[model samples]
Target chain A: MQQENSVSKLKYFPVTAFSVVMGLSGLAILLYRAYHLGWLPLWAYLAAAFTALVVFAMFVFIYGLKAIWYFEEVKKEYNHKVKVNFFSAISISFLLVSVAFYGYLPFVSAGLWYAGVIAHLLLTFHTVVFWIRSEFEVHDINPAWFIPVVGNLIIPVVGVDLAPTWVNIYFFITGMFFWITLFAIVLYRLVFHKQLAEKFIPTMFIFIAPPAVIFISYFRMFLNVDVFSMSMLSLALFFLGLLVFLVKDFFRIRFYLSWWAYTFPVSALGIAMMIAYQATGFSVFKYIAVFVLVLTAAIVAAVMAFTVKNVVLGKICVMED
Target chain B: MKNVTVVVVYIFGLITGILATGFLINISAETVLLKEMASPYDFEKTVEVLAKRINSTKNWHVTAVIDQAAEVKGHGEGDIGKLKIVQYCSGKYAYEVLADDNRKKISVMMPKTFSVYEKNDGRVYIAVMNGSFVGKIFKGETYEILEKVSLEVEALLNFINFKFSLF
Candidate 1:
């Protein structure tokens, strides 16, 4: 029996299959363009870019089918096989670029690098459409038609020299919105859902890892992550509230661990923002505000760490088991 | 042991992602290195040249320096973006990219900087390449000066720093 939220699996049979094929082809051309690019030619880059956008359309289809977001077929392909393939594809692409970069093939390597950027953007879009809770979520309105809506974005940027630049910045902003919103919803689910923070908290260390990597990556790109960090800080605020709400239930050791899970990402972001504010220069109000927030976060994390010693690991956890 | 194994996998993924980013960043950083300029010019000077040449500042804010940006320290052998930020502007060029319709792509170029910076010793520097800008300008029938803008800017740098020796 399918869960109430799990919609039918076969809602997007044709659209999905077509999208997967186009996506595979686009990625194949992009990969070949990394080395091959003989018969395909310069226009092939445009073709791959176009095809990649076509792939983004299919995501709209998948999102349209909300409940059965993870059909057996979709799961089999994307969750396991495609994830490994794309991850390796990016990894190998990076390795090749590294070799060529040191060897001084900067021109060719730069082109491939930008193309890889495009691929990564596609992956980010896919993750948002499939995983996040938003208007684009599969279940709500079913915007499979929105595929072409997004594809329309490529018409302006494609075949132009500025295509990559224009498309990349555009996608970066949109992707940030999606990722931020998703992060918020996940936090919401954790707070209200109760059991979620428990299960995910055990893996909270994993939660801290990816966003840290993403923040670091965005930083390296010369992106002013003040906005992203601000969003992260907002999440930290909610986590703090949740921690405070649960403080009265001092006996629940596992719930307390959940608070720490939230703190990890929140504190990481608060620290990032503090560093940013320092870089921005000294506005007393801004500095005081950032200082207070960071100091509060530090206090929270310090308390959480101490709890592991004072209560959870030391006493509470010891008592529970 | 299972917990340790999981943590190990998590750490492994983090390292891999970072390595991937570093590898890709190298290509963009290096591209700025090899692509040479035809003359010695600073982006500010280029802005001046462009203003004089084009006779229009109405749509272009040429040679704008980006201030208060954090220096991208410890990047690598040739990471220039971390050092300096030089912004350029041309609404006409942006109009061209957007293809005279659907202004959404306009945000891509966003009247941003080409970003050039000189080291304290003035030996090393970094900047961005406008492959499309050049490609667009030169490809057309006019042997347009805009075609060689980034190259000229590089040349301008060579002049100022006496490194590439555009003179």
Candidate 2:
């Protein structure tokens, strides 16, 4: 049984520890120089850094709490090393920040939004090699575990906004696959390999956050690309849901009516598209047709699932126990 | 022993002790001087377009001033009249956000900044933010309209990169 205080206590570390540290470290150098030398508008840099740092600090505290909770869940003896990964991740950020602030402009800061690009490319390469030969074998990797860690790595990548496709695809595919595969693995493990089914909560952002971005990106809002890239994002999230529901190992309470949370944001977008297609007056029949289109799509997906072997199930079935 | 470890990992948590966010926001300034604006963004058009996109936002101002405008001393034609800084925020939302919690310093990044400028010999540069970054600060119960607002900002920035050749 899960303890109440324990579970409640273990929140926030992953979000805070690495993200804030690196983000500030990378960006703070600029603020520090501006203030000491009085080069750029000090107020804005200070404000962004201060705000980001405070938020980062709280998130770090929360991440630590979660680490403690994880220790509590594992029922393991612990100390500061509980957040060893987090510290290292933050350490890297510190290193990058220090390097960045010392006036090492690789190209251009582009915009702060692109800051993740640098970190993304670096981690993308690192993670790709790491994934191709991940030492963490024998057990299924946790999406929550990897997202923060890899994200910690890529978090710094945004230092500049753009990178060649080859750079990002490596990280993008690896990151997405890890989570996507994690979702698949969870399903089969729940069905047949029960022992491997640990407390699995797919990181909230793994699907909802990123793919929503994929859709937002579809407007060609930030990066201009073809429809297929955006469409794949929608497909990725859908598969994520398929993986979530297919798994018996999930935090069912969170799922109770959450398919709606998963569906509404995206589907309404489609409905809006339909409205645009019709233009002007409302048609009840059109609304019905739109409803049917969504329902049919969901059904098609479910049908496809039956034909596909569960990734975890396939793995377990082949394992020699 | 195993269960005990779980309890401990469950106890202290990973990021508990550090004050991860605000430290940097309030930090003393330094310049890495990394930003190389290939081309300056047309802030006037950007502000006009963006103001209409955001709901309840008021007194929006965007500028493309010399590096001296930011009060920064230039090194090699450093701020040589190349960069643009865009500052924007919503009026009522700012008030509502501040009133919510003292620690919601994330919200204080309101009237946020988006800088656009040109690198020497001209490469037009334009950029804004990712939704996830802003989503953290918005903190509404429902991501419904908030998600759209985030998307709109991204879209506006993308438009600059696309139609205006900012990117």
Candidate 3:
């Protein structure tokens, strides 16, 4: 009876939990760049990469068990509107970890990159088809809708070297097209519709990731600093500033697993700044890079601590209202 | 009433003067503190030649050559052109500066650096701090030592024909 009761809780293991891996892997890749710039010690990158890998494995193992034991429950999550979007987080975790290991382990990195690319492409297809077939109320559309789109943008960060140029470009163009379309829809939803729920408010930070990832991927492809790349970077910075301007609203909300949404986007912005500094050789960019790095570190640490606290208190992994 | 107007004018002038000074510093800081010259050889050859010359010089040793472009690429930021920083130090000069407690603070500038980079114009250039100009500001034994170091640095760089600087 005791074993059965404990096993029954597996049904509540939310698919959204994969987002923890996304956040950790993003930080690991950012620290890896900082390590190369001589801004951080090698141990910093190693620790972050190791932690991300371990946590990702743990989440995948647990979530896999949940799928096997509670197939119907897992199916319910996949069929849900908002919950389904986070499934792409699994593929994104693979791509980000692939980037973090690209320097030390090329073979492993290439394998993971292939898996991530194929998996993300499939997920993108499923998501688009789902959106077309289903009717979503305007209120149902939120920043979480951008997750699959953001995953596409992340492909070329490592895919440029591992895959053919045309393949990477294909992913880049697809991601850019969807990003613009979704940006307009999301903006319309925010301004014209009812406000997002409190739990979903942190997803607003998702606004920072697409353009920042686009900037990095664009720079990696062409290796140039042109007007288009700069505009993407500036747009990302503008959103970051706008979020900071409305920080009080964020502070008022209690912690939810969605808080993990704040981590990867901020990390992406910081990584973009580091790339900007390298491309332009501007001292101002370098200073901004360091500043964003420090801010990202603090945000990730705080979110992780809160996550651990909630897990210990049995506040997480329970049935939602 | 006249006295108050005079005070307001003086305050306005002082603020304007401070702003102008700050603007000037922002514009001139790089040129005043550093010097850049074109390198005849390509990026890799320039770094190799400088490292070989420094190692061959008396009492000087090449400490490290940092390939920043490779480093950036290795970490997945992609290439940012050819940028390398070469660090060299002389034990004799280091000891001369560090033997005194007061002069030890100058050790920050000890392992002198030379930045060899390729600009967008596809020309390779080498840049180093203007040690002599900086030394003159100190105006003491430090100035004498740095002045000598500057002349030796110029001599080591004589392989390139003197011409116009892109800086």
Once fitted onto the true fold, the runs of candidate 3 whose alpha carbons sit more than 4 angstroms away are A1-5, B1-167
Chain A of candidate 1 gets a TM-score of 0.33
Output the better candidate (2/3) by TM-score. Answer: 3
Candidate 2 residue lDDT tens string, A47-105? 64555456445655655455444545322211122222233344344333433322222
For each candidate, the DockQ is: 0.03, 0.06, 0.02
TM-score per candidate: 0.30, 0.34, 0.68
Instruction: Give the alpha carbon lDDT tens digit for every residue of B8-77 in model 1.
Output: 8768956876676566555444333333232245444543453353333345555555432343434333
CAPRI-style quality class for the chain A–B interface of candidate 3: incorrect
Off by over 4 Å in 2: A1-140, A153-198, A201-232, A243-321, B1-122, B126-158, B161-167
Model 1, C-alpha of A48: deviation from truth (Å): 43
Compare candidates 1 and 3 on DockQ and give the better one: 1
Candidate 2: count the clashes.
Answer: 112
- lDDT score of residue A98 within candidate 2: 32
Which of the predicted structures, 2 or 3, would earn the higher DockQ when compared with the native? 2
Error of 3 at A89 (Å): 0.5
Query: In DockQ, how does model 2 score against the reference complex?
Result: 0.06
Error of 1 at A231 (Å): 8.0
